[model samples]
Target: MIDKKTYNEIGVHIPSILLPKEGIDMQKWSVVACDQYTSEPEYWEEVEKKVGDNPSTLHLIFPEIYLEHGNADERIKRINNEMKRYINEGILVSQKPCMLLVDRSTPHTKSRKGLILAVDLEKYDYSAGSQTLIRATEGTVIERLPPRVKIRENAILELPHVMLLIDDPDKTVIEPLAGKLDSFEKVYDFELMMNGGHIRGYRIDDGETLKGILKAIEALADPEVFKSKYKVGDDKGVLLFAVGDGNHSLASAKVHWENVKKSLSEAEVEDHPARFALVEVVNVHDDGIVFEPIHRVLFNIEPESVLNALQDFFGSSCCSLEKFDSLESVNKRLSELKREEAVHSFGFVTDRSFGVFTVQNLKHNLEVATLQGFLDYYLGKQKEAKVDYIHGEDVVTKLGSKPGNIGFYLPSMEKHDLFKTVILDGVLPRKTFSMGEAEEKRFYLECRKIVKD
Candidate 1:
């Protein structure tokens, strides 16, 4: 169990984790993060069919794709009630205080490792230019929090999909834990549904192991060590943790904590369950973690008008387009272009044509940034047009081929540049990049109580 001193020192706590009882179907009990599959309602429909009348995380969390479909109030009520039911019926049994070490194996990527623990929200800040030890890697959209807040405010438990990144280049913290897995107890080992992946978790409750983990985290956070690693000046603020995924959820937790803390006394606030949010901290340099670019797909817009706007926005000198005969051609050219040059470029697939667009004398460090700037302005004028941040290039090709839709394929950003970029330039634009494909995202496996009993 983690003590108050460790919590204060590392801003992490060993949680009273809740897991499915031994008899329950583990595959049905777990689900992907709710925020995923926003553009694909059919995916959620399959999940609903699979989890029919069974106790599942799907019942506890609201999928964002359905956010605008109405009946949200009723859904929230049911979600909260289900949480109470799950706890009261012993479907979710409480475990001893410990951190969970997760090994996630997906078909497309290497096995990813993560450590799950409750992060103290008191030490986190997601607003612009936050210098807190835990910082957000992308800008938080304040407007996106209301729906999430509505779901979380009355919810009894939290099952996190939030992934935290520590810039541990030498693999000191989580790597060492892998060697000591035999000393800990195995918790859950099963295959995820809908071809998501296989996941296995082990409990880390040993006192000596816990202390060593905390010590390593402290070393990473040491100011001298941080400065030397980043080669930054002495006056620069230290950033120990970066929110790699689920920044909005973490921000929402912070918001809810801020609102609820007003009613608590100093003593009551010290170890409040709501004050800590559960997240998996993974090293940014982990071999298994792959950073993939989030491409854009615009709907309800004419392809010709989009092309015209792009040409006008960037002008003849800076912007140019080269046509390709097919999606395969576009993909082949993009693959080659990625290797040949450092120029800002994006591959596009529309109903009218397949092509690559290049922007010389780029304004931002990333091609996504330059494209996003234009799209923001273009969409403002073309009010009927809507944009969705997509994951894979193949998805973009398929979706953008539909009439009145266009997709922009962006190249992946270097994972190594994440922390340094966020520290130097504040947060990157929203929907900048994804840690992996949709299926590789963290599943909602473990739950923790947010309301004190």
Candidate 2:
């Protein structure tokens, strides 16, 4: 048996990872994360056409776009049924007690290295001002979590798209393994559908390497080392793992684990599969880890009403708005802003026009937080308005320019700022950053049985 103490100390576990058996078409079986391309139904439609009637991850996961179409209970029911069918029919087979070393090459970058891991939820906390081993980099939208929590509560096998990030400046953990990949067993290699990317998986099942990886990760969490690295006081919590890609997904897993623990004995809880969430852990220093701004588009609200509300909510005296003839002008203006000039600047688009809003004397470390503060306050006052975090400038612009809609194009934070920022600041405003564009997001390829026998 593997030492649970070693795993617990490092907040990591070796999963009996699952994949489709031989003779199955791996291409159709893999799908991009459900959260991507929310406004583009045509993207999912194309995916459906490619995966028709096959035993695919598409069958097990419910895409968010389908949630608004109504009969969500029916969709959830169908999803549960498909999971059981796949498991019982032997579609997903496991290579016992292993971690997957992944080499993913997307169109945007050459290669991103990741290790598939099962992280202990007990060490994770998403609440504001967390000091746990695992922390959230951005604020989580609690209202956006219920539907996801419901899906996970009944999920049999979890196909992970969530990614955890480590700030290893010395390249201690993942970088050293890249040169030695040939010694490992190659498991899966294929191109992702819909121009997503190409991925190759290799198995890491030996006890020697697993022990070394655990030790390296544990060293990163050393309180003294962490304090010196970030120049933080000893009173702060150690933040070894930060949710990089799927913030809410890990939050949902933590929620479901909390709920599950209530019904179990303390001993039973220790060994349950649901206590750990499957994730891909990548080094923040990875060459392919591009930090992109997650844009926002609010629907069913008058664009003028939103601007008026923003002006009123932040107080008319503190901020100023400048109008532009087109989005190009707004972009050019925002790019021209000096570091000292902009407390923060947001470029916006509406059905009528495009402009940039500059706010000074900020209340938060990030502009997203300042904007989200106003949005939450504004949405509470009106029942008809709703917001969605969008990927890509074109999608946000197109959606924002539609009638009765508005989109705010936020700026991307520096990639190097992530670990230190989250260290000193509790968490940034929700929907603060995205790992890459929608097409470059992690695709679902491997599965681990989340249900205990």
Candidate 3:
């Protein structure tokens, strides 16, 4: 990550970080990304009981499960107030301007390396077909932006769970920090609540170390290097950072920044606090990084209606549905699928039926795209029906098995194809891939002052 002057080139910089004061129980302080466990109220219920009035991040973020409960404006007010209160009460303290090296080991993954920094919103565009330095790996859902923007409107602080991905196959940017852990100050080391696993952070304030990281990031961002890596010409912009997790959150931040900068003069915009958003940068090749498929669950729609909609969306000939008695068999068949590129298979589940839906001569490269195209068209026509991107196979299965709900279990993406695929093809369909399952996600720990006093 670069400092303010060069943040434009890499779209990343050392940020003025915020952390809980010493003696605060990190176990109760840090929680998983707000977006996770949306379909399960029980999960959040347990978390609330554990974090009960403990001055935790639970107070700072509005979990998605409670999004529809009511009083959204009131919730936003409470969030902004908590941010200011934390600052006033010294519950949150500024860590000065610096970067952090993170070593997180989840129950599922070990020693997953990451760098905590801020990304220039000006250098990021979440729209599809974006050629910016930091582009979203998946399509941005436009409707998801307004609510998120509302959360940031009056909020003074941001606790970022957006994990950005870099195609650093040479292990240059973040991996090198593991060897020099002794050179940095250990900031926080604790177990995350709710089986999120253990994590430790080291502050990177060394000039020489930061300089080396900047050089490595610069080399990766070189236009020639991007072209050579993707086998493309110089016509395209170099895509160094891809939004792997928290796509909508990052998109909302970009939207918020765009709105704020419009009222400011050019001079004011240059060093504006809201101009950059905090994020964790992780190498795509890191051993801890794995692309889990994001499953889809349709609510308030019958399985038969869903099938008919799909049939109408993609002409009957190219689309076919074959029924199965059990999910196990459907999954087995979908797993054995190694067919032509154009042929795609998906595992489908409903209260009454389990099936495999196949699409021939696919309109999109991935199964998620083909299905998302249909879902977008279908949902536009059917207001009562809505889709939610799900993580963890069990949750999706349970939700999909509920009455009046349909779940489409998806296949995972190959990590090797991510960078080149994004470079050649504009972006994957929204909710295409997740870094890990629900519990493995990055918890809200580091905070940054997004607005000046």
- What is each predicted model's overall lDDT from 0 to 1? 0.89, 0.89, 0.88
Q: Which whole-number lDDT from 0 to 100 does residue 287 have in model 2?
A: 92
- Write candidate 3's Cα lDDT for 295-370 as tens digits: 9999999889889888877789987888888989898888767554568889888998789888887667888888
Worst lDDT 10-window in candidate 3: 1-10
Off by over 4 Å in 2: 1-3
| Local accuracy of candidate 2 as per-residue lDDT tens digits, 1-453 | 457787788788788888898888988999999999888899999999999999899998889888878888888888889988888888888788988899999989999999998999999999998988999998887888999999887888788999999999898888888888889999999998999889999898888888878888889988899999999997888889999988889999999999999999989998899999899999999999999999999999999889988887777888888888898999899887645554778989999899988888887878788888888888898888888899889999999999999999998888899989998877888888998899999999898887788
Each prediction's number of clashing residue pairs: 0, 0, 0
* Candidate 1, poorest ten consecutive residues by summed lDDT: 1-10
Clashing pairs in 3: none
- Please give the distance, in angstroms, between residue 23's alpha carbon in candidate 1 and its true position after superposition: 0.8
Error of 1 at 133 (Å): 0.7
- Cα lDDT tens digits for candidate 1, 78-148: 99999999999999999998899999999886589999988999899998988899999887889899889
True-structure lDDT of candidate 3: 0.88
Clashes of 2: 0
C-alpha RMSD by candidate, in order: 1.5, 1.5, 1.7
